[model samples]
Target: MTHSASPFVPDPSRYIKRSSREVPVGPVTIGGGSPVVLQSMLTSDTLNTEACVREALDLVEAGCELVRITAPTVKDAANLRAIREELRRRSCPVPLVADIHFKPEAAMEAAQWVDKVRINPGNYADRKKFVVRSYTDAEYASAVEQLEDSFLPLVELCLRRGIALRIGTNHGSLSDRILNRYGDTPLGMVESALEYARICRKAGFHRIVFSMKASNPRIMISAYRRLVATLQELGPDWNYPVHLGVTEAGDGEDGRVKSAVGIGALLADGIGDTIRVSLTEDSVREIPVAKALRSLVEQFATAPRPRDRIVPPFDPFSFQRRESHRWDRNPTVGGGEPVRVAVLEENLAALEAASAGTEIVPELGYQPRLVEEVDPEDSAALTALGGGPPRLVTIRDGCPYPPLYAFRMLAARIPAHHPILLKDTFFPGEEGDPLRSLLNSALQLGALLCDGIGDAILLRGEADPRKALELSYNILQATGNRSFKADFVACPSCGRTLFHLQETTARIRKATGHLKGVKIAVMGCIVNGPGEMADADFGYVGGAPGKVNLYVGKKAVRFNIPQEQAVDSLISLIAGEGKWVEPPSS
Candidate 1:
């Protein structure tokens, strides 16, 4: 069968624009329009060349696009070289990256054989000169010069050998100058790595990758997002391949969750070029997790495209088909009609008043009177109120006691015989210590509550009450639940804040009240807005009192929209795009 030119067209402009350099890591192309790659490092002793090679091969076999091995000493560097030769001789085609520290000779040796070299700028200080001379301005300059010279040889070797370089900066080992200037922040990490990248570029080596590793996943996520945004602001033409990871990600389940949240968020935003799951266990075990993460990203994420591209037309037929399937399966929406709404509340007068202007049919029931209160007879009434099992439940604030206790009680009271839906609640408390402790406790309690009980969990933060709600909705959807309400998550601005955050957030919430399952975050400043609010479906960040930056799902959609109209504009955009639907009627 001969193929003909069809209606489908692959637009060049739709491709994410990247630097046109050959990424030297295996089949993975980093600084180009290739798929984002997944990589991991081997924890095996580098001095044992055969063991390192075996781990590398295992990682490659497990779908790792690249692998890194540590060369801690000259002997380890020699072993690394031997491993490279063995791979070449055995026709094992995976690319190897050599991670080096203070030993510049080892770095130089590895650069000659490996595809890439990772150097920590902090650890690369010239200790030889520091030991030899007393502290002085002259001595400091000489030390810096000596350090530069040491790296220069490796840089030269890499340049000649066509090896890519990665200036990997870590939070724990930040250079004194960077830490002093920018504090131990994401911006500081970016500055330090960029400074090193500039030095490498000036030395006639341009193939570079960068990573800012932090033990805190949230910080890591924020740092990378800021770095990417900053780079874009500097110039669209300025692009660098990035290596992503959550440093010291611990071991086992906790590490996996942390790594997933950090790496997954970046991948969702089209920011990560490569990933490493930096677990405390044998790093080779991280390879499979890295591959799994990449697969998850490819499966669930929206593909990245250049800003210039006209977005492809959405397939309305597919959407309609999905809705049709849902409607058919839902017994409440018989005859292909929308489901009826039912209100379930204990305060009959308040419920009546709240439902007065709405089309909902009122169903009066006794709400649980206390934490341990339960009535088996209420199950049928609750089901009827929701027209089946509720897909979502909202727990009010001002609980009589600790919120976690209330949640547990509610979870226990809900009937176990039916498909009882999950619930999200708003808990009011002060910020910082109390809220953090509350959230941590809630998570632990939630784990118990969710044991074969609920489908999703949401912890409401007092910083922005609406944001807590929105986060609940997103978390539900992310966990495969099909129902929720819109929530807005806004932050309290400080002295460095750029806009009238409080007023703007209130106005946005009021303006977007009609939409359900939508999430909007109005952040006080641009620095933390993008990263801290990564989970938001829609975000309005303060640029100035009258201006704000708008984002949808990690991608900046517009900038400097009028603060008064930003919320309305976002609502209009969501409606026009038809990306979401009304909550199903009970």
Candidate 2:
């Protein structure tokens, strides 16, 4: 039956055009243009065939199109065969995928019993411990060649029997040769697996799936992006089903969040063909999360809709109406002027010293004020006075109230037009859940509290504070507010720094501290300093102890200042260039 000509359309058929080389795994057609299937493995022991079968049935109900069972030994393979038979007899619908490691004999055995076989190339080449204490390079190669010969028989068996193959690459198990060639990157994983795919294809096998699993979400996302781009470049006909997964995603909340971010990003981008959320705990629960992710992607289909005039739902971040009058009005004071900013110091002496040469206006636009101190009458009067409402309000620590709950209450009481900023407070005993819950709640409230928000987000161990600040600034800047300061991109110096970069940066910051809208970068090494600091308005880079390269944008303006005087020299340069000025006192 022609898919488009049919009156009844299958939901999966709506996304993927049916393919000639399709592999049907239960209700899901893998190779044919079908919505990529989400699959997971049963963590239950295969030795207990009843438990394994029961788990498979549960996963099927949970929307797992395919389920994998581990067969580590000959005994395990026997149990897996029995489970498959039991499920088949009971008329269970989900296809079973057998996962085998190291032992090609076990894989060969499981191939006859399961619908698909998942093999790790690294495991195929593994030498048994009892073989030999002194095998020559040629002898080792001969052993591998023999193993490859044995493995091909299993591959051929699967192909001849119409069983699918998945060349699964785990981050931990990548061969040292591939690592040496491609530096343990996603490219290496793809290249390694493609080589295996070539072997399968050469043996007259076209039914295949590929997966590269990583615990790090960023690395996983990057690898998948690169792989998809590479496949597209290879040509349209080269398309094959790609399985997405964040492997070793720790059990519970951490795993859920990590899997969601990694899987969600790829699904949103229209790349993944299948997904697996590999949590360390019971595999049964993971099926729901994986199915939910696929459902989320279906809602974001990039395929052009049938009607031209149909208006879809607006994505909160991307949608902005030109007719909204708020965009035209100058919503900030100082005629929408940018505010000068400085990191606060506890010492009043240093604070006074930093503010010495800068003009401190009584009210410069929407300064962040303590929420507890702001009177209700004053808040009302400010609205009555009306030259744009205050932008930020810091919730003081130890204020005898939950900041988020209090903010919600305050938001209800405040004038509709006024927006308040809720600052993230650092507490000794606070955990991530409360902070995440509060932040998510605040985001949901929209523009009622502020145009946008900022957090003094702290990082753990060794990360550059400047990089953290830049990331935070980018997030806030994306909100379309112009009153923010230029980001300070500085690196935390290590023993490698030729100059005392940290102290020098502090001094330069002290000198031009009053300049709010200017971005200054302080970097340790010249190698990545210029490139990394390309986004900054100005940069100071260390060359040697007592020497600095001053940059305005990307160009180097001056170099070779005395070690002790480098900070002053950069400051003088800023002042001479009219980038620094005195501030009015309170």
For candidate 1, write residues 1-586 as lDDT tens digits. 1112112222211222233344666445786767777777775667767877787787777777787777766777777778888878888878888877667777877777778888887666522111222346665456556667767777788888877888887654555555555665777777767666666778878788878776555567557756765565666444777778866444444355446656665554455777887654554567767766666556433333322322222221011101111222222321223222221233345545654644232322323331122222245533443334333332345433233333333433343322222222334354544323323322322322222233223343423433333333333332223233344544433323466554665566556644666766666555435544535687777766678787776567888888667777877767766854553353
Per-candidate TM equals: 0.50, 0.50
lDDT of 2 by residue, 295-376 (tens): 6556445333321111111111222211111212233322223321222222224434554543321122222342223422
lDDT of 2: 0.53
Cα lDDT, all candidates: 0.54, 0.53
As for model 2, its CA RMSD to the true structure in angstroms is: 18.4
Any runs in candidate 2 off by more than 4 Å, and if so which?
1-21, 126-150, 302-586
Could you tell me how far off, in angstroms, the CA of residue 442 lies in candidate 1 after the best superposition? Answer: 16
How does residue 364 of candidate 1 score in lDDT? 22
